[model samples]
Target: MNNEVNLETYEEKKLRLIAILQQHSAPEIRLAKNTSNLFRDRKNISGPGLNVKSFNRVIRIVPEEGFAEVEGMTPYVDLVEECLKYNVMPPVVPQLKSITIGGAVTGIGIESSSFKYGLVHETLQEMDILLADGSSLTCSPHNEHKRLFFGFPNSYGTLGYALKLKIRVVPVKPFVHLTHIRHRDAISYFADLDNHCKQHIDFIDGTIFGPGEYYLTVGKFTESAPYTSDYTYKNIYYRSIRERESDYLHVGDYIWRWDTDWFWCSEYFLGQNPIVRRLLGPKRLNSVTYTKLMHLNRKYNLTHYFNTLLGYHSEAVIQDVEIPLKHCPEYLDFYFNTIKFTPVWVCPIRPLNKNARFPLYPLDPETLYVNFGFWNVIKSRKQTEPGYYNRMVEKKVRDLDGMKSLYSDAYYSAEQFWEIYNQEEYFKLKNRYDPRGRFKDLYAKCVQHG
Candidate 1:
């Protein structure tokens, strides 16, 4: 159960990994302590030498080029603070501060501004990767190793381990001029979201609190802070909107605002009483701390049992599906009328490069997408198990030509997954780069089974 690996220089780590591979078969690449809940049941194979977490360092910033180069293990919070000194930030900062740049690049990470910038991988200009054989190479979108670069996203580190990355950053003002618009139904909510995207708003996202009730938030970077709220100390945007009509927030505050409540899920444990929340402080219950504690104490299993007794379902039921713009209303109807999960989150994202090696689901570059996040509890039915609901949603996403984020459980069969993703090209590259099968197979590790 020892999880620690001796720290070493980048070159020394690479040589050590090569030496280890020569002796043992393939070992698991353990980065952060947090595991993606979707792959909770999957066990990592033993026999590794290098741990990239030791490489956590912010190398430097190039203000003229509008980019920053940092080691793969650098956390989002650290990156943001460094970038803020130059008045520039990553185009889409994932909601959680603990998410690492390497994790986000390999996995999918999005935010309010994703509607314009696509996923975190798309914002990456170049990356330094260590292949399975321990060779290092720098790749970019137009480089000779372009296939490895584009196919790397959604690969789950099977292709290679990211050592360093140069990511695109944008200049920002001191604060965000926030506006809240209420919508009575899915049709109007989406319509307004479309308008906001067309107008090129700096940031946009909404919450479907209940059937026919939604709140659409749009923000623009500005130096003027007519009225600013203490979102960090007082309340998260989701809760604060209930009391105030509108208010501004420090740019950093607005970016990680969802961290306070982990997108309103913390209320389940902390209680809905504002007085209690003030006394306890939201930082104590932030998602990173909560997840680490659950893992350390094995309390997650206890929570699952308690949920079943209380008629609630497992945390695995939480999921996010990205649907094409045209099919958003249809998916919303399915979510509200059929599944009955409340407070669904909605955010828009543009399509990635069509010719890219790894094809994002619903790989229509001409079309936009609406990410529908259902992060709530569910009740099991008599004829169906709790997993039945998730599989049904997965089928619907496939039917609508959409893609479900890999961060959640995927119920697709080997054949079904191939149909949804470009499996042939991915496997071809995997064979070329990791012929020994040292890394975890994406399907075997992530695909769920009964």
Candidate 2:
């Protein structure tokens, strides 16, 4: 459970953060949090950070009401642990253990449950935001700050920093029953996926093995399981999907199944091998540890040097974009013929609140969208310009009328970026909430890397 928030201490910390921000008049404010799940590195953004690290705590969980009040910096792992004690969990828990609730809402968070409950921000009930002016205000759908409440999801801390958040939680059972349905054709596969979403399912996500192989995993909460398979170490979760028709996992383990392997990215560090797994143990075999090692590799340019020595032009293509469900097959076809990568993670998400439109990250309220996530380095014998592959992705997504999550590398021109992410509304919100421009605008922070 980590630590529970104290009533008085939360107030003290809020006042401290406000005073700190007031004392430091720098316009480029960022949170002084310890962990991050962001993929892209900031180039030169520098300013004194608000020390929000102490705000990581679960405030309270009301099981009967199916909601939990938590500090913005509380990680999903800690939030889940505390909620599970009451036999409930957040409606949509992001796969990563280190992602903070604030980070998830601001960036983007989606999991298997997203098909039913929508994305992480869509599940939020209320938020307490610390505006750039160092004033705190509570916002909800029916509150006076309703515009900020809806617009804050994709703001990435530009509008304000969420000091506390309340999210919807659902009851959980002892186990989860998973049924893996395999499909060979993309059209029929997506059709079946949309069909399954109509059912009263607890979780739905797909894994694309290749052009010829696809798997739709449907999970349901159950009271018991005959036996549960472990993928925390040694065994891998993705490989098991193709090898089995049905599987069982303890509820907690199922929520975190993809995290143990970082959705099959652990092989880069040899964490998948049995011997390596034994040496690293469970504690070290997580995204937090892997991210640290990745930083070291970046510091030393280990992968870069190796790729250069091999005479290959490399581009890191790590992105997540959601295309309309009807156009998913077309998206998949382009992906197979172009930025080819195997085992793409797909999760379906539609607005849980159809009447509520989040202008910053707009989606057709009636349309179902499937998020395609592929993270890997793309290399070729021939050389190309920077963002060569990512630009192709941005163009494709634009042509398809899809939305891209800005947590990773984005290669959009200012005009193109604004056109896709509602520039008019963003400026209006900025002028209203942060007229002084105390924080970087979405374009500078995301596209220009500040």
Candidate 3:
């Protein structure tokens, strides 16, 4: 509904998926333009490479009003640029610009600004979905398709495939104020977030940079000020090309700052092939060899530090488990002591009020969700290897009755997956809304498998 029907496949899998959908469903399905480009064959990389390639596409449908109806497949990077051209932006935007809107809605999505605006799904006005019967329906809070709208976020693809979405957008300035502050521990991070949320700051999040080095980055928009041609570089000390003469820059734009350059960088990152990196730049190589051995494609790079760090040796198996805000500390201890992996990325997400009504995880009223981005470094050794650390990591997660995130194929088994989210009520809703079971896909198979 946004502008085009965007869908695509990586390598033969994409074709396989498309074939599967065409075979299982009606042929009248329209393949919208602007499909995903990330579906390159996983096993066909020319040289040492990342193992996975993922993609999100944008399908658009112009409404009677000026608003654009978007598909879940819509990529976040493009959406920000498209919306900004019209002076509007989604309330919640992911830090990794390449994340798909659909990916965020179906999975437990988060971003730096979540403290104020919540996840991307919270900003939706309506969703155009393809039901199991191959029919299309628009779902929203005010309409009859309300049940689908409510359950669709964490349901993965079991409920339905999003055709288009009628979403709310907000106006944004052209610049950003990105300030990096050093913190001692998690205590300072939370306190700073609390203080920043009360102000006009647009976004905030921090990284636990090793033992004592913590970087808390915050962003906000301000009025245009006078420019200083000869600038002394301070916080952003990493890398940059020599500045050209007469170029004015906005602090707020950051990555969304340039669409084409961002896309090229994203494409290179996701390519994951060492040869590609060699072709692009040797600087892309990680100093850590194990991380270099990961063969992880660019899409997974968008994941948090904890997941990527361990993913070097182990395929990441994350479970977006929730504990009430009060219990977050307890859960953190349970998680940290239980796993051997160093540097776990814990995202403390604040879910919408309605999501709280379900009480899926053992949530408290002040329930701030602590998302477990559990990392498992893939090892070349067999499963029987005694020293293998991945097994230990998996065992710890299994011990905790955490809700497994239903995003990538690397997640747990179907039984294990559902046990995390308890899809029985969702099944009942499925029966009520789509008795024919037309929405069946790998996601449906996993969620509903006996």
Candidate 4:
């Protein structure tokens, strides 16, 4: 490790970054980072990526203040490990380890803690955003850039990049006690899901194996557990939901329970195989390794080729959609009926601050919403048009007054996308912060994957 580089102050790093940005003469700006948790692919850009890799650092953790100052490209893994040193953790730590604090805010991030703290963005107290013009400014709920603060949540980096963020952190217990509440019916299951969110708890989320099998797993922080469970290696967390009714984990293990298997999506890369897992070991069992392998598979078109050879048409339905709690059961019914993909994730969340509304990703402040996260390919023996299933998901979400996270493939046209994502508010911020069009528009970046 370079102690000198690590000791460089935030101001020193900022100046160096500005110099690098000035030297790079590109028509467009994009982050040059080491990791990504995004599921979407982008069109090649004819410009050098802005090297913000060194911006990865934790400025400070003020336990008394209940916040941690983290750099833009700092991954949650790094941030969480540091926060834990102070016996504190981010209020809403996204499941994936590689997910950056900046990316999550600009894109959208949520977790099991969302029922109490809301989305990762909601845990934000303030941030200093580095704009396309190589300028930076602090934005908060009641600052001159208040609009930018509220509008930044779902911008997808179209507006600017969060260079530094002050995010809410809460003290953590040494262990977490988990209880899996099983529900055979969607109506009763979803009803109880909403009911549980009203109760005081540390973390809560749900999972579905198939029709008539739903597990609402709840966790409460504890000083100690009877015996801690380990999902980081051989034993899978998602599968454990069905095997055990109650469980316990160390605080760190509980916070990162999903990342070990990428919420069961690791099966795509055979990371679950006993032989493969043993050979790979715990180090390679994470989402980072699987994500890299997935990218490689996409680059080689191996899956498509095999599917064609096997006479199967597949559509990747990797998405997280938020539906009003009352209509979640309906969405579940439609999902099970149409998609039929088992082991979909279910997390309930509502606006942490009812008075604040993020226009770019609007949600009814008064209503609780259930986030359905399903990442798998839907295969058919027959051929279908591109985005056939994804289009269906978009339409159904719209019909039910739901909002979909834009981290993966989307089929929404420009007009329809704008209507849902608050085009007026987005453009206003774009005009104010990036009037020269130095960055790609949200529609082009997300929908077109430019």
Candidate 5:
């Protein structure tokens, strides 16, 4: 047996594996690090068009000058820890605690403050890739190899493997001030968001539990207090205690920021008694369901953790679509009418930075993002039957022309993915970097057969 072990990096491994497949007869092979499980269980309810069957095997990160050179497999939770030592933080982060950087990049990311910061791809400065030809290149807008920059944002792995990414980071802050304001409806909540935009909140995200009720949550650095609250703020007085908590759980990595961040939900629900908490789990609940049951009660924590490693397992057929700023009303009507069989939770987030290098959903400078996620016990519903939800979403997104959140392995056609980015340039770049069709399987279903 020839024994020349391949010492290629994780990003290069895909190309190496592809080459091996072309030459060898083996049908099953193992990878170094695998995260396909995260996607395997998730059913695509709508947009970001994905129905992933597997993920890359390994995720690695190499620290570089002013940035961390991350492999496509690095998990976000791990990357946050690595960046903490440098007092820097990734700009755009997904809401989940375990998502990978590659997943976020491919799916495109939006979080609490995407309105101000933009998506994860917005923070990317440069990327090193292994193309179909097994050649490596570093790409950036300012560099000679610029095509990769255009393709990296939403291409998933269709263009090439992102071997080394130099993403921008900001100084770590001690705390964030979270403001929660309840609204009676989408009209009232969105109006409030526009009114509050002048304060320049660090991040803005909120949810509507029912048709007439909403909650607007905003985040900002501690020092930049935009408003005063009546609640007693702890940790600020005890520096040592705060420091200890920081070491154990980095606040930046957690979506709520700090332990106190739990106050908004907990205070609203009254407390985390086991009985109430159990009710918080999967149910025949919709966004409106939460509101109708808890009407203006924002005091309970939605601590969705299964007691064991699986955490509190919950299921929701989420639907997300990007609409032009002026079309929010039209989109909302379409979304509301389609979900007769399930409950729906609506989330409207602002796109990362309004000003970005690439094409994200174009929003009216004043438009807020609108996301609708549902929750239910999958084992209890008939709609959960295979291919039903997928077919429904495919039809809705295509007819509505709204952008989908590409996080879950939701089914989406390659045509939808291409349409999201508006095609031509993406394919041109693909032809330039991977003319051999080595990354053919990575194409959106539409692109694959077209």
Candidate 6:
């Protein structure tokens, strides 16, 4: 089977898929290896999926044109390394290095640079997609397939399978000069972030450790630096900045800096023991590496077992809520008073373009929004019910006219989900592209009303 799969070329893969689709009523399409991890419980709803992992390749780089065309399964790490040789990179590389171009494009991908570039999909120049009927088309922002292109992001592969993507890349320096600015309140932190976004900063994000305590971090790309620390080899940027300070990071290091400790979440397990900390360090136990290794441990499924046991005492509620800037203070108070999660990530992102047809895009295009990432372990029984806290947070976000990241577990009914998103537009695209319902709808798979 492996040999036959290897012999099949890209065209052959599409032909085989068309044959399979004709035989079956609906077929799942696996664009990349382990892409199922993006879904909860690693579930794929479509019947007998078509695997396109072999298509992982970097086709070409047009440095002069400021764009790179890569196969859908191409990982961000591979794409970034190739682009770095030409001193250019995707404007918004997702924080995780293992994330693929297809996943990032189909799903929403954001980073510190999001404040300027919007989401990863906003930087896409064009994409080659295989539709449900086994037909292929190249799509762009202002072309014949503009509707599909605009509605692709946050769709989670319900529209089509991304075969090839031409994404916008920007020139970069060798290092990034980072400054950690401390703020005692949400108002001041956002005020400072607003100022920096107006400047020529390359990256911007913040961490809210507790109520009224925040650290707004900003970075600028530079040709050279006097001092530098490689995050892949050293401590995470957030932990290293115990006090207000400045530092420099190699371009690659700066891009995947959060991968070291998975944005400091790994510390919960690896930092508990001194000997283990000395032996493995946070880098080895990095989220991506750790998850890959755990997937290899077949005997016990260590990652699931460990996390499940940990939840017995203290459950971890990890989610990202994008709230309008005007209601940020109210949301923050509710978050701290009700949810009480710690080590929250605060990122300011521009509203999606009014012309963007993606239903999940923020509704209020006139307002600036902040993504509050609540990743904390809670022990309280009141907050530990199956979906109690999730429902609570979801309702609060809806009340504020905000949207929660669908990548995380959502506890909204189909009606509630559509209420927050542009349901009419979504159904229109779904009907046109996937009329047979061959692809799994995002709402059915991700949102849990029960």
Q: Candidate 1 — worst ten consecutive residues by lDDT sum?
A: 1-10
Per-model TM-score, in order, reads 0.89, 0.97, 0.64, 0.97, 0.64, 0.88
Better of 1 and 6 by TM-score: 1
Query: Model 4: which residue pairs collide?
Result: none
lDDT of each: 0.74, 0.90, 0.48, 0.89, 0.50, 0.75
Which structure is stronger by lDDT: 2 or 6?
A: 2
> Any runs in candidate 4 off by more than 4 Å, and if so which?
1-8
- Residues 292-396 of candidate 4: C-alpha lDDT, one tens digit per residue: 888888778888889989999988899999999888878988997898887899998888998998999998888888899998888899788999999999999
Cα lDDT of model 2 by residue, 1-450, tens digit: 333445677788899988887878775788788788777777775765788899998988888878888999998999999988999999999998999999999998899998888889999999989998888999999988998888898889989999999899899998999999999999999999999999998999999989979899999999989999998877889889999999999999999999899999998899888999999998888888888887687668788789999998788888999999989999998999899988799999988888888999998989999999999898899999999989999999999999999998888989999998899989988999999998889999888886
Alpha-carbon error at 44 in model 6, in Å? Answer: 8.0
List, residue by residue over 1-450, the lDDT tens digit for candidate 5.
Answer: 011222254435545545644453323111234333122221222322221113322233333444555656666656776666566667776654345676677567666556666667767788766555546688886787765675677665666666556677666565566556667665666667666655666766555444554666666666333333221132221122212222222245234232221212333343244455455542311122333333222123233232123443333353455544345555555556655433343444555445444543334444555555543323222324444554565566556545665434355555666666657776677688877665543343223221
Candidate 1 residues 3-31, lDDT tens each?
12222455575566557545544454533
Tell me the spans in candidate 6 whose CA falls farther than 4 Å from its real position: 1-32, 35-39, 42-48, 271-274, 281-283, 293-315, 352-357, 382-384, 448-450
Pick the winner on lDDT between candidates 1 and 4. 4
Candidate 4 has an lDDT of 0.89
* Candidate 1 ranges beyond 4 A from true positions: 1-39, 44-50, 271-285, 293-300, 308-315, 352-357, 360-362, 381-383, 448-450
Q: Would you give me the overall lDDT of model 1?
A: 0.74
1-450 per-residue lDDT for model 6 (tens digits): 121223236567657766765565444553437543353444444445566776677777777888887878888888898889889999999877778999888778888998888888888889988887778888898898888888888887778889888888889999999888888887877778788878988899988888867888889999999988866644555676556479898999899888777687666566434576568865465556655543454235554456556654444466888888888888988988878867888888884465565556655556678888776546652335676777888899889988787776777777888877668878888899989777667687567411
Task: Report, for all candidates in order, the number of backbone clashes.
Answer: 0, 0, 31, 0, 42, 0
What local lDDT does model 1 show for residue 168?
A: 87
Summing lDDT over every window of 10 consecutive residues in candidate 3, give the lowest-scoring window: 230-239
lDDT of 3 by residue, 1-450 (tens): 244444432224344434445455342222232323221112222322111123243344333343555645667767776776666677777544545676567654666666666666777778766555545577887688776777777655556666556776766666655566665665565556556656777766544434444455566765553552211111121212111212223633453332222212233244344455445453332222222223354335444355435543333433344333444344555545544343334445565554433322222334454454434433332233432343343344456433445443323456655555555767776787667665453334443231
